[model samples]
Target: MKYIALFRGINVGGNRKVDMKQLRTLFESLGFSQVSTYINSGNILFESELDTKSVLMKIQNCFHNTFDFEIPTIVKTENEMKKIAKSIPEEWQNDPTQRTDVAYLFPEADSKKIIEELPLKIEFLEIRYIKGAIFWNIKRENVNKSQLAKLISHKLYKSMTIRNVNTARFLAGEKE
Candidate 1:
């Protein structure tokens, strides 16, 4: 299976630094082939015979052993990533007018009917939930006024690994 491992909170603010070359080596050491990293935010794409759960467990175990920190990871199949990217409207690009993001939720996180659960009462905030992630778009000018702006402080934020729409497109093989 081809898997994309979205690791959370790594290589941020010069902390939890993980070199792309070393990260590739780490994945390769676990018998995964075609391992490659994108943009150094711990997005690893690779092939393995094991299922998604098995791959996640192996990576987490070896990752902590090698790096000495537990990485909160969400593993998605290539098709799933593509679906996530496809679900977003074409107009929801991050630009001067609006910002779009995909919050890839952890497996243990309760994502079902998340749109109704999330605090999206603001008029400028647009939110949608599929199986594995939440797609949100907010007007840039109104972001500060919207409850979505405080997602970082929200409880659901703890269970998510967010990426911009462009990153989501790239991960889905829909872009450069």
Candidate 2:
């Protein structure tokens, strides 16, 4: 199955500097095929027979052993991506600018509970869950300043990558 591994805190603020080539090598060494790293932010797309949990554990362990540091990782398969893409709330789609942010949640995440705990003033926040993934659409200028994004890192306890609606669609290979 094709999977995307999103790593947190890599190549950010000059801290965890991992070259894409090394990242690809690490994934390939773990038996994944067609390993590709995107945007230098630790987004890796590859194919592996192992399930998501096992893949996560393997990748995390490899990263820890190779880099000597722990970085949260979130794994999602291609099917999961399709489900998340289809689940973008209709209401949010009506106002594109109001829904400029897209967050891809881990397959094991409990989105309902997380949604319920969001801070107020989120303004037009919408979440859809299907096929073991959660898709969040939020209208916000700075994702970091958004309450939903701020709380997600704590709630999921896994690495997360927030792309603008454009980047999310691009990663998902959805037509603009």
Candidate with top TM-score is: 1
Put down candidate 1 lDDT per residue, 1-176, tens digits, no spaces. Answer: 88899989899899888898998999999999999999989799999999998998898889878887778888999999999999999999999999999999876664666666666665778888888998889888888777675667777777989899999999899998
Best by lDDT: 1
Against the true structure, candidate 2 reaches a TM-score of 0.75
- What's the residue-level lDDT of 111 in candidate 1? 64
lDDT of each: 0.87, 0.67
Query: Which residues of candidate 2, in runs, are more than 4 Å off?
Result: 89-96, 106-109, 127-160
Q: Per-residue alpha-carbon lDDT of model 2 for 104-160, expressed as tens digits?
A: 555556455555555534454556545444456655553445565456447554524
Candidate 1: C-alpha RMSD to true structure equals 1.5
Model 1 steric clash total: 0
**What's the CA error at residue 92 for candidate 2, in Å?**
5.7
Question: Which portions of model 1 miss their true places by more than 4 Å?
Answer: none
